[model samples]
Target: MTNPRQPHQPRQLSLNAFLHDTGHHEASWRHPESSAERAHDIEFYVEQAQKAEAAKLDGVFFADIPGLWAATPYRPTAHLEPITRLSAMAARTEKIGLIATASTTFHEPYNLARLFSSLDIISGGRAGWNIVTTQSEAVARNFSLATMPDPAERYARAQEFIDVVTKLWDSWEDDAVLADRDSGRYFDPDKVHAINHVGRFFQVEGALAAPRSPQGRPVYVQAGSSNEGRAFAARNAEAIFTAHQTLGDAQAFYDDIKSRAARFGRDPGHVKILPGISPFLGDTEQEAKELQQYFNELTVPAYGIGQLESLAGISLGHLELDERVPVELFAGSGDVLDNNRSRLQVVANIVERDRPTLRQLLHRLAGGRGHNVVAGTPLQVADIITEWFENGAADGFNVMPPLYPQLLDAFTAGVVPILQERGLFRTEYAGSTLRDHYGLPRPDSLYAATAAATTA
Candidate 1:
């Protein structure tokens, strides 16, 4: 632990704990090791955040959907709004980044920007927004809409949304607040300016009510993998959270995103591409497989079928559980780079390569819903991380444990030490802000630049 690593290294791996209710496994709620009954408790989340911070992870992320999950009938489907819980977490922990999902389709830029700005200020610069275009019609209904917009229209609106929000965030300059008791002038009027944004999807005007946050602006993170999604990320996302099932697929995605970012006149290194990894660990390889099988056996067939049907846009009524799934079912998704249905393409690759039975496919998807799932010892998991990092397959990983506190604890305790010893990951955090943790600099304020130009 003392000398295996050098004093200085060019790049260190970034890791985030992708926290779900009980765990990432569809049947994890049924496992005895899980805290299934306490899903709604704020303390439950606080504990997880503390654990991740203790291990010096880059951050903790929460994926949100306004409506119930498709497999809600089989698991605990309720959730506390991520921002509310994270605000509480901000006060409890220091240094770890706080990221939460919010759909551009459902939120107006003004209110969303204000919300994140406040969180950034409150967290002392450790806030991130995982931008998403909610794809579910069910979720749209919650907002009193009849149907969700098509992907093209949604992405178009999101492009404008990002523009408006960032401008609003920069409405107040970095040194706007004066807080002078002697003069009684709280802020310099000259430092604040109206955004006055007008676009196809929105019209937001005036400066933000919240003062400039510590990071200047919150980090922009994107999770979509569609063609439009990639283009959006290339143009705007500072960090990207994605999923893949193989080294080849992951490597291709890594290269394509970096190249696309460069074409947009953006620094490719500024876009950190972190793929989701769900590993079930044990002391030995056989034990790991057995542990994974334990969770797989707990999955309800109906629930797994519903999840598959949703992702693949196909029905499985005709096929028996043990029968082979036809490769032709996913013929349209052959091009991984351009496929709008990002997750279905992962399943297609799985069926084409391994030729699994319907049941086996279900088991595979259950572990992480098309994210890479590995059942191995801590050493094996470390090898996977190292291989992907060294080979340009990933910048880092989104560690998703199969069960709460237990699996997460296992990862931080077992796998983290290995990563630290090899100098692939940081043994301790060196900075206070989320941007600092991700190796990103605070972005220059747009309004500030405009003011300086006007003065000149």
Candidate 2:
């Protein structure tokens, strides 16, 4: 079958509904339409998934922190586990892909493989795993560690973890299972091979318990933007969930990853780069800015301070909210900045660009927490998305609405039609599986492909 995800006449845009509890904004729960209590409500997510499906979005994505993200009392930081939530969404909605975040730093390879494989089967081939090397000392404590592993060590382990998982996924050939009662054999034993994968971080000696999924394996979605992260995504990721504050940075990243993929002997076109976008929409531009400002105004200063402290790796609690933040506080040598890249880079970008006071900086990050926040009318939002897509800055966007099912509703009801009218996005899903949704080909199992080649 021809892969639906391959490039066709029109360059279709890939959009995902990046679902958050109340929403993406730090103070989203304070909105009249939001409720902290509803964050745990399965029905709330189901409604969100259904709405994305209605708009013909490619997928619904959920990001997880594994531990308490920040001061929970100040902000509603509690969240449902991502993979489990996506499973629940799978049953309630069809067509939209279900993508979940899990950490390589904490999860075992075998268990992670089994979990994603099972989800792929259960979701009828609509599963995608957002591979993440979680960066938090707090999360390390939950896993019985005093400090997080260094970046090099963590990425090394992640590479081995993914290698073992992929080998396990490829162990069971597509034709291994046969429900032939008359022959008295349910499966072909010869077709099922033990991986015997021995890696630096993991070892596995058996086939995955689950058979090859409908898409061979769940789509590999990665979310790392550091140097090692970029290299990792180039080798393995089918889709990347990324965050960037500027168009130039996004384009540079897009070019670098594609070139890296080509160097790895992989089709660069197969790897989709999706930057996160938080759209706070209104019928008019001023109205949109004011609505986003309302969420910013609701942010507790203490919460923002704590967040900045983590990013800057310094004690910013002593700083006055109205006073201009000392730029030199976070200014360090090249080696030091490279050590803590993603969040620090984002923070530095904001600081250098605007040189805001502590209070101003908090509001700046309040919208998408470092992702680009576009507060505008429907046309303005659509135009921005189109500009990014057409200019090679992005393959698509992970649409993060500041408020769940409300701002999300606005984006779909308002902005999506403009994309559809311009023929930049799909009006309806042409295929069923998540791979199909992303225009990725269903790959053959390594064993199956190898055996076929040998026989020929």
Candidate 3:
């Protein structure tokens, strides 16, 4: 006789380790445990992936910027190409999703589709693509553009670019390759088709050269929080990475994006929203706070001021660092449609709410760009995560450690165990694919679904 089981429990939270060279802190390289020079070592990344997998974390993410972020002389700024590196790490670890950031603005649809498809296959369906539109004017110049591409134009192209790529992924049906040896037959020609995709920005005339990947296609991810970004994500993204400083802000964004998805005839519950968090951990609350302060003291005021000026789009070099920044400094500089708008608003919100001095604000931002920074013991950190997960502020978090290996080790070894005890996270991986790790279903091919619907 079959055994009967108890009632099913609710779904668990999804977590990703957002990996950087040393860590998320600006001065992380100076930390005793982190070495900035190890950024390019494949073994370094291999070790991190293994650590995350050992903890049963869902995934590892690599953020990319196509241009120089700052001209700082100190700190490490180098990064390995993500897909190539993920491909290497795929061989070293099992059951951990590998996500890479790729820009739609610079790559052709055909090549990008092939690249991610290859990664999904290489990783046995554990590949995800973080879609972004390159916005830096410096990077634009490298692509032969005399000026920055307008934000509206970039979003429009991105929407169509996604449509074309998804079509390519669906061009070959799962059973297209019969490989009959006795008859000396290969793939069935009728099951394979030409996408013949022609769009405003991209034109392609052939089917994708690869067979269907294990998860059907790589998972789609987005990081932008603008209106256009929300709409695009609603139509396409299965997961979103975002930044917000307060519970209210996070709830609002979560509701807005899910509502947008509903309007697009999608099931909002399928889209996972993960905000970034940089945790400074210790055995006691007081110790955690002290460690956070230590990192802040290491911040170079000049570099911080330079970064602040870049975001505000106004000169602050002449102002006293201890003086309160005038709210007018951000006026007329960023609009909702501009590239700087989202990040600028994050800073403006901080100034308006707390009215901190420039020095104080810089220190607050030094840890995780604009993501919320939490300092506490393991249980305290777990409380914040549980509250967010339970109260609808987030589906999960992009866990960023302020220092490499050590802080990450602290989180997984200390905090994750607490979460597991509370039944808020998984004790073991549920399946092999990245989609399975995220609790997201593999998508059906558009053509196959359409034909089945017609027959029914």
Candidate 4:
């Protein structure tokens, strides 16, 4: 079955709603309608997943962190593990794709591969893995590492990790299972092969414990913006979750990554780049602005300062909140700047363009740092999305709401209708699995084909 909104055709767009626990904004928990306390509740996530499915959105994504951000009163911290949460969501929702973040830096390749492969079978192939090389120092400590490895070192390990995992997934042939009761020989040892991967990061001398999943492999999604990150995505990612503050930046990233795919002998169309967008909605433009301001007012300045200190490598706690961010702080932080190039570039751009005060920077970055934060009516939001999609700036968007359910519902009910009417989004699901939902072909079972050829 073909997706009506397949990208091979003109003017078609794909959308994935990125669901945060309470909301994208750090202070979203303070809102009256926000259910921050329900972050740990399975029912809360299930209801949100159901809503996205009801809206006929393509997928629902969950972002994760191995360690809690420095304890803050301004925002909620930690919740259910993402893979388990997505598994629960899979039970409740039938069609929508379920994507979850898992870091190669923290997880062993064999265990990680098995986990996603199991999820694919459980969800009937509606699972996706958002690969990330976690960068937090705190996360490194939790994993028994002295410190986070340099960016290049992490990417090198990630490449090997993925290689080992993919081989493991391909180890079991599709026809390996033979549940024949009469013969009482429910086995096909010849069909199941062992993966002897001896890479720098991992070495696995056996096949994956599970059978080949429905999709062969879970949909490979990535969310990294550095040079190594982009290269990794170019070679391996089917979907990319990225952040950009402007259309020009988004377009540049889109072109660069697509161009890089050619070198990997990959079809550029196979890599779908979705930038994060957090919408602040209201009845009128003025009301939307006011709502954005309300969230800004609720942001904790100290938390922002701590974040800034981490980013710029300078402690801002001693500085006055009303004062301009010190220029001296950014001068010698080239190493820090290069490490998180995308985010540092965003901060530098904002500093140069807006010259915002320390308090103002906190408000500006209150929602998912520098991702396009727009406040307007649904039609207006749809216009922005349509413009971006049609103009080659985006394949789709990662729909983030400043607050959940309330804001997500507004976008689904209001903006989605406009997009559907414009032929930019889907009105109903056209396929069952996440691969089918994305108009992707199910990968051939390497083991199965090899065994069949050998027998013949």
Q: Residue pairs in steric clash, candidate 4?
A: none
Assess the local accuracy of residue 425 in candidate 1 as a C-alpha lDDT between 0 and 100. 89
Clash pairs, model 3 backbone: none
lDDT by residue for model 4 over 330-428, one digit each (tens)? Answer: 664333323366677677777776777888888888887778899999989999998788777898989999998899998898899999998877787
User: Residue by residue across 109-167, what tens digits does model 2's lDDT show?
Assistant: 88999999988988889999999888888889989999998888988998999888988
Worst 10 residues of 4 by lDDT: 330-339
User: What would the per-residue lDDT of candidate 3 be over residues 46-86, giving only the tens digit for each residue?
Assistant: 99999999999989999987765565786776577899999
Note the Cα lDDT for every prediction shown: 0.89, 0.87, 0.88, 0.84
Whole-structure CA lDDT of model 2: 0.87
Cα shift from native, residue 333, model 1 (Å): 2.2
Of models 1 and 3, which has the larger lDDT? 1
Cα lDDT tens digits for candidate 1, 1-456: 011223365678999999998999999999986898889988899999999999999999999988786635788887889887889999999999999999999999999998999999999999999999888878888899999888889989999999999999989998889999999999999889888887788887879998989898888999989888999999999999999998998999999999999999987888999999999999999999999999999999888888788767788989999999999988888553432477888898899999999999999999898899999999999999999999999999999999998999999999999999998888878788888888887877897888779999
Show how many residue pairs clash in every candidate, following the order shown. Answer: 0, 1, 0, 0
lDDT of 4 at 413: 88
Residue 394, model 4, lDDT: 90
TM-score of each: 0.96, 0.97, 0.96, 0.94
Total clashes for model 4:
0
Q: Which stretches of candidate 4 lie over 4 Å from their true place?
A: 1-8, 326-339, 448-456
Candidate 3 RMSD to the correct structure: 2.8
